[model samples]
Target: MLEVTGLHVAYGGIQAVRSITFHVNEGETVALIGANGAGKTTTLKAISRVVNAVGGDVHFCGEKIIGVAPHEIIRKGIALVPEGRGVFPRLSVLENLRMGAFVRDDKAGIAADIDRMYAYFPRLKERADQLAGTLSGGEQQMLAIGRALMSRPKMLLLDEPSMGLAPIMVQKIFEVIRNVAAAGMTILLIEQNAKLALESSQRAYVMESGEITLNGESAALLHDPKVKAAYLGE
Candidate 1:
């Protein structure tokens, strides 16, 4: 449902992302896996319009979004759960979740969605009144994902959902991710955790030095020697 073609992004004379082309089919998860500085996050930023693309185009649901304003992105049915789990520190968990549906006016639907989020992450319901900044890393990650889903997005952009968390916590987060994907959420995941990314996604792309180095079925890439050596560490 999303297509990025010849995408290029440069900042401060450093090319963060080179011309890269990829697509995410509707209702499938596509992972972009790489190490630090691989331009994984930049590619998401460009697609989400958080950062400008110097060249190429981003089409979501067949409409160009490259020149679209950042605030307008949510209205187009795309939500980005950015890296580092950007949450409203000063706001309570409940307040933060309410903010997610800021673009909408349907109170009944928003209320129902809040209950749905609480069901998705029961911990969020427990910490309903707690300040977001005080939640643990995993909790904040859950909050981020829940908040994004409040918009009822057609596609979700996830950047490093596994970063800075305990192994058990990562497992918990991925469980939720699996649930979301199973329910037919279209996800374009950018992850430093290659193994998790591959296992979670249906198709995968290996990015290196700001370009796509390999692309194929996730299961095949899991067994590919080059992918194993460079990313899987096998």
Candidate 2:
């Protein structure tokens, strides 16, 4: 449902992504795996229009989206749960979730989605009135994903959803990711934890120095010698 071709991004002469191409089909979970400076996040930001691409094109569901505004992109059924979980610190959990539906006017649907989110994340329901900043890392990540889901997006962009959480939390987060995809939401995931990412996604891409170096089925990539040695610590 999403296509990116020859995508390039630069930070005033420092090119972060150079001619990378990839696609995520409908209802698929595609993982972008790479090291810290491999420009994985840059690629996502470019797709989300948070950063401008200097070259190439990005299309979502057959329409060009390279120059569109970020909010416009979100309204077109794409939402990004950024690397830092970018939640509103002072807002209550319920309030944070309501922000996700800011672009929508369906009060009934929004309320129903909120209930669904609470069901999907029971911990969030328990802390529904608590300040987002006070939640634990795992809970905050849950809130972040929950908030994004409140927008009723067709595709979700997740950047390091497991980043700072304990192992159990990481597992739980991946489980939620898997469930989300199973429920028919397309996902383009950027993850540093190769093992978890590969396990959760159907297909995976290995990125380096702002380009795609490898692409294959997740299981195949997981067993590949180079991918295992470089990213999986095998």
Candidate 3:
């Protein structure tokens, strides 16, 4: 449902993402994995229109979205849960969730979706009135994913969902991701945890120094000697 072709993004004179191409099919989870400076995040930003692409096109549901405004992208059936779990620190958890549904006007549906999010992450319901900033890192990550789901997007873009969490917390987060994918959410996940990324996704791409170097079925990549050596530490 999402297609990125020959995407290029450069910061002044420095190129962060070269001409990279990949895609996520409907109801599929595709992972982009690589080292810290491999341009995985930049590729996501370009698709989300948070950063302008210097070349190539991004088509979502068959419409070109490379020119879509950052704010408007959310309305076009795409939601991004950024790397840092960008939550509204000053707002309470409930209020933060409310902000997520600002794009929609279905009061009853919005209320129901909020309840569903709470179900997805009961910790959020427990902190309904707590300030978002004060939550633990894991809680914030949960909040970020919940908030993004409020938009009811056809596709979810996740960036570094395991960046700073403990192992148990990561497990909890991926559990929800598995549930979401099972529920038919098309997800484009950028994860630093290569093992988890490959294991969670059905298909995968490996990036190095701003280019795609390898890609295949996630299960197949898991046993690839190069992938094992470079990403799995095996």
Candidate 4:
């Protein structure tokens, strides 16, 4: 459903992603795993148009979307749940979700989606009127993913969803991601927790210094010698 080919991005003279290529098929979960500053986040930002690619192509469902505005990209059925959860601190849980659907005009559908999100994350329902900043870190992450789902996206770009959470909470977050993918949403996940990310995804890619260094089925990569030693604590 999404294709990135020969993609490149730079921060002034510092090139972060260099001619990277990958794709996420419909209803499939793919992961990008790397250490700090490996360009995993930059790749997602480029796909979401938060950062412009210096060269290469981004196509979603056969349409070129490289230069599209971030909002437009969201409208085209792609939503990004960035690292740090990026929620509006002062906004109520319900209000933050409403912001997610700002690009849509279907009031009834939006209402239904809000209800669905509440069902998906019961905690959000309990804190429906609470300020987002007051929620616990795990709750805030759930809110971020739930807010992205409010847009009813066909594909989700998740960046570091497991960062800073307790182990149990990280497990819960991955469970939600699995359920979301099972419900037919394509996902391109960038995660620092390589072991969890690989275990959770169907296929995975490893990146280093802005380039794809490895790509394979998740299970295979999980047992790969280098992967085991470097990421799996082998």
Candidate 5:
């Protein structure tokens, strides 16, 4: 449901992404796996219009989104759960979730989605009145994902969702990701944890030095010798 072609992103004179191309079909979980400085995050930011693309085309549901404003992009059914779990620290968990539906006007639908979020994340429900900054790392990550889902997006862009959590928390997070994909959520994931990304996604792309180096089925890439050596540390 999303397509990015010949994407080139830069900041001033420094180019962060170069001629990158990829796509995520309807109901598919696609992963962009790479090390630090590999432009994985930049590609997602470019697609979401969080950063401008110097050259390229980003189309979502057949509509061009490269020039669209970030808020407009969210309204168009794409929501990004950025790297580092950017939560509103001072706001209560409930308040932060309510903010996710800020672009909508349907009170009943928004309230229903909030209930769904609470169901999806019971910990969030328990801490509804607690300040977001006071939650644990795993709890905060859950809050972030729950908040994004409140927007009722057709496609979700998750950047390093497994970052900074304990191993058990990571597993729990991936289980939620698997359930989301199973329920037909179109997801484009940027993950430094190649193993988790490949395990959770149907298809995967490897990026290096700001360009796509390999793209294929996640299982095949999982066993590929080169991918194993470079990213999986096999």
Candidate 6:
């Protein structure tokens, strides 16, 4: 479970995220959907401590994690798959996955998780020894998600898993996400595709110009006139 209250983030003098509050329950997939510059990615970065929050609080599993170091955040059971699929381009697919488990020393468990990742992403298995940079965009995204899963995280922060991919590949990526959620992974997803995000998540938040503007059950948000007009392109 995760809770973020009155969160604020800034870069130098630019205020990026303002007073964003939301929660994701255990085994639930909560989505933050918005247009570019809406601060969805910044909010996730603040939650993961990749970028520090200037104000407010973040709690994970009942403890305040606002100031925790990024690596410590992982140790506490949260993993972030950032926007742009920040995979180690030079590393082999297998090696990239290995790096994901860097915070852990469970050799047997890590290896088993690698196998599980392969199951979730068969393309990765085929490219096990290949350089990650040489893979297609969609494959790289899959690798990013698989790498995050390697950490055996209690919750996943996914930022734009469908970005820059073809329609079929995006469908594949969302299918994997749905399967992961079905298997009880708690996910906080930041996505530009509002329809997909709302459809896949239990609850949703809409952000505009650095703040949360609307939030509710995803199904209800999907039909709201404003959401349909602005995000669903109706």
lDDT of 6 by residue, 113-181 (tens): 999999999999999999999999999999999999999999999999999999999999999999999
Local distance difference test, candidate 4: 0.94
Summarize candidate 2's per-residue lDDT along 179-234 as a digit string, tens digits.
89999999999999999999999999999998899999999999999998999898
> In terms of TM-score, how similar is model 1 to the real structure?
0.98
Off by over 4 Å in 4: none
Candidate 5, residues 1-234: lDDT per residue as tens digits? 999999999989888899998999999999999989999999989998989999989999999989998889989999899998889999999999999998888999999988888887888899999999999999889889988888889999999999999999998888888888898999999999999999999999999989999999999999999999998899
Minimum summed lDDT over a 10-residue window in model 6 is located at 67-76
TM-score for every candidate vs. truth? 0.98, 0.98, 0.99, 0.98, 0.97, 0.98
Model 6, stretches more than 4 Å misplaced? none
Query: Pairs clashing in candidate 5?
Result: none
Clashes of each: 0, 0, 0, 0, 0, 0
lDDT of 3 by residue, 135-230 (tens): 999999999999999999999999999989999999999999999999999999999899999999999999999999999999999999999999
Which residue runs of candidate 5 sit more than 4 Å off their true CA positions? none
Assess candidate 6 and give its lDDT: 0.95
- Relative to the unseen true structure, what is the C-alpha lDDT of residue 154 in candidate 2, on a scale of 0 to 100? 91
Candidate 5 residue-wise lDDT at 162: 90
**Residue 123 lDDT in model 6?**
94
